[model samples]
Target: MSWIVDRIRPREAPSFSRPLALLVAGALFLENLDGTVLQTAAPAVAQEFEVAPEGVSPAIVGYLLAVAVAIPVAGWVAERFGTRRTFLVSVAGFTAASVACALAPNLLWLCAFRIVQGVAGAMMIPVGRIAVLRSVRPTDLLAAMAYLTWPSLIAPVIAPFLGGVITDVLGWRWIFVLNVPIGMALAVGGALLVPRAEHRIRTPLDRWGYLLTAGTVVCLTGGVELLRDGRPWLVATLLLLSVTLAAAAAHGMTRREHPLFVPEVLRIRTFRAGNLSGSVYRLVITGAPFLFVLLFQAGFGWSAAAAGAMVTAVFAGNLGIKPLTTPIIRLLGFRRTLVWSIVAGGASLLAFAGVHASTPVPAIAVLLVFSGAVRSIGFSAYNTVMFADVPRDLLPAANGLSATLQQVGTALGVAAAAAAAGLGTGIAGPEAVELGYRLAFVPLAGLLVIPLVGALRLPAAAGGHATARR
Candidate 1:
């Protein structure tokens, strides 16, 4: 998330180099892929667990929520513990956790292992980036940073298709089992190649900030999950409490001596605009994939293999658009690029309603691919605008805040989509889950409106600083 992007500043050039950088990037790729691959396998996993496909979402949402909770502390933990130790431990823990996930006997067990995976992931990414920041020279910083950045772009494209293949050809379990080798390789490579720096003078732990922020995420995610449980009063209470806790957390952060995210970062006009818009953007785009996979397998009755294979069209879009992202943003400028991208994304989601059981395969592929390209462009622009205007001293905290909010928004998006589908299923009666899938897109597409309007409000020359450098 923002943690990965935020850490790659132009550091003092190190003789330490890109091998170490690539190794760290490899670790991140595995981490990012782990989060996304689950979407393609959710319907299949649901069958294995004897639950609704939407029911599998708690495991997905739980993992992301755990990552979101753990991310704010990663820098502190890495600094206190040393990046090498933390990174090594994280890779080991994540690999072990993936094994447990593959071996899980029930949904609860699976969700628990995923939470562990998320924690390890939270450690792996920031620590890895911290390692690169310390070791890479200023001259090599761009290449090193680009290596780390690729995972965010590459993983989402291939995860579903790859997850589908692994699930269909091997089993759903192997999709998780696949992480072991990658993690092992990264761990070994990291041990041998990564530089070991002495611990810094560590910052005091922000105990109050940690508790408030973690509590806010937990209660909000719990509230969202409870919405589908058919308990009206409980849902209302949890949601109300989540909002209350969020306000309290905001207050706690502002008053703290050393806040997790400095209060002033939010006051930066460009950062504020980017964060708010990015949240809504991620919520819709990230959640739609979860719903789409479910719709393909559970609703339209496609085989897991078929659904996975076909969904590669979206992956294709993500891949094809990457090289063009910077160029497009530079030429169009941030505001225009973002506004048009959001429009394209919103249109694509709206068009998904036309994808029927009888729709041609090629047509579906084209739609997903085009949508994917549009979404990618918007994401790239938002990430660029995020830190573009922050003063150098505040960049780190601003990046951390951006990363935290990114995960939270993504997790919430997935939850919202699933919960919407669940509620629609209930309203439409049994054997009508497909209708729920279609209805869920209404809100998913609607979320783009927030980012669209936000992007429009930005100055025409927003992100000029970042774009000029690119």
Candidate 2:
């Protein structure tokens, strides 16, 4: 065991070329944090605005729809405008939206501002990724991805707690108010850190491709949101529409000379594993926090803060395991690291299914920490390898596609968790609420099989270049 650690240990510290990756990670944190924070603030916002809590759903759903609709065209926007300029504008726009949200006089006004925020957020992440991919050397790709991965890991876990604190002490509007300074700081950092691309691609925008792809995203995400509201007919119609558009979009990509995405990029086996199968991994991973938070509160009769505190254990694990993640990947290679992480992550979920009110707090925390750690490793590996073999020319399209799929995966995760939890409750009966929540983990763990199978099939040398194993 000691030899194993020693072997994976870095001989010297890893270094990044600039703070650009960190800036991008900050942007990702803000985007993720804003979405989750609103979940906590909904009731308060509704009260202040004199509406039903569900009335606030429009603001949330509107933002998500805007993000989904805009994501498919992010690459084109970056190319047409330029990466640095687009990123700066995105940050500025998001900040201004935040201000508008803070000052919104009514639900309608808040929804409008949130839509603006969504459009900016849609542009912020993928463009930042484009900047990073274009500038970072292949040797530093893993480290750069590591920087970008933490925000996604940490932000969602902490937001519920942080949002509750802010809403309780200061009020819900402060949630948006706080983004002003962070946004300003990120804009400054991006300007100083992110390099201008030496060249830009000026290909004509694939208008048809954009419409089909964007339609697919909107219908898929909006349908899922509609499901939670119990609008079965609307959800069904949107699901069918989404499927039709997706099939058309696939055909367009392969048939068109210049499609929104180059179909050939999927032929790169590593990228395929990360982009396609990795989404399955993300869906299960993203859903866990949602389940755990609800389980601790509704199932165990714990307070909201207490439930949130348990998630903080997972957050702690994400950061605690970060320094070792790259070394582990370097030592074992992406395939082995990913395989082990998936298996370990599944085992952690199974462990979660066994936890009950009588279980020791320390035991639950340790299990959560382990879950968070393996998830971190798996995510970094997937993100790095997704672009491992993509040609420099295809980076923009590849980044846009990956970003779009990732967003869809994230939206589906919470929905999946909700659906699974509902099924578990039905099976267990209302009298066994705790068991119902515990049962939710069973299916989520089972979903891991999809990615595990994908990992098992990966070539031993997958993502080798990122780790300098070539």
Best by lDDT: 2
Q: CA lDDT of 147 in candidate 1? A: 58
For 356-386, candidate 1 gives per-residue lDDT tens digits of 8888888888998898888878777776676
How close is every model to the real structure, measured as TM-score?
Answer: 0.86, 0.93
Backbone clash count, each prediction separately: 5, 0
Q: Which candidate comes out best when scored by TM-score?
A: 2
Q: Write the per-residue lDDT of candidate 2 for residues 1-470, one digit (tens) a residue.
A: 98898788876534454477778989999997876678767889999999998788789768767776788888888888888899999999999999999999999999999999999999998998877777566787887788889987888789878887888889999999999999999999988887765577788888999999888888887786666566789989999999999999999888887788888878889989997889989988888898998799889998767788889998888999999998999999999999999999999998878899999999999999999999999998899889788888778778898998887787677777877787788779999999999998998889999999999999999878888831
| TM-score, predicted candidate 1 vs. hidden true structure | 0.86
Q: Which 10 successive residues of model 2 have the least lDDT summed?
A: 10-19
Least accurate 10 contiguous residues by lDDT in model 1: 135-144
Off by over 4 Å in 2: 1-16, 226-236
- Quote model 2's TM-score: 0.93
- CA-only RMSD, every prediction: 5.7, 3.4
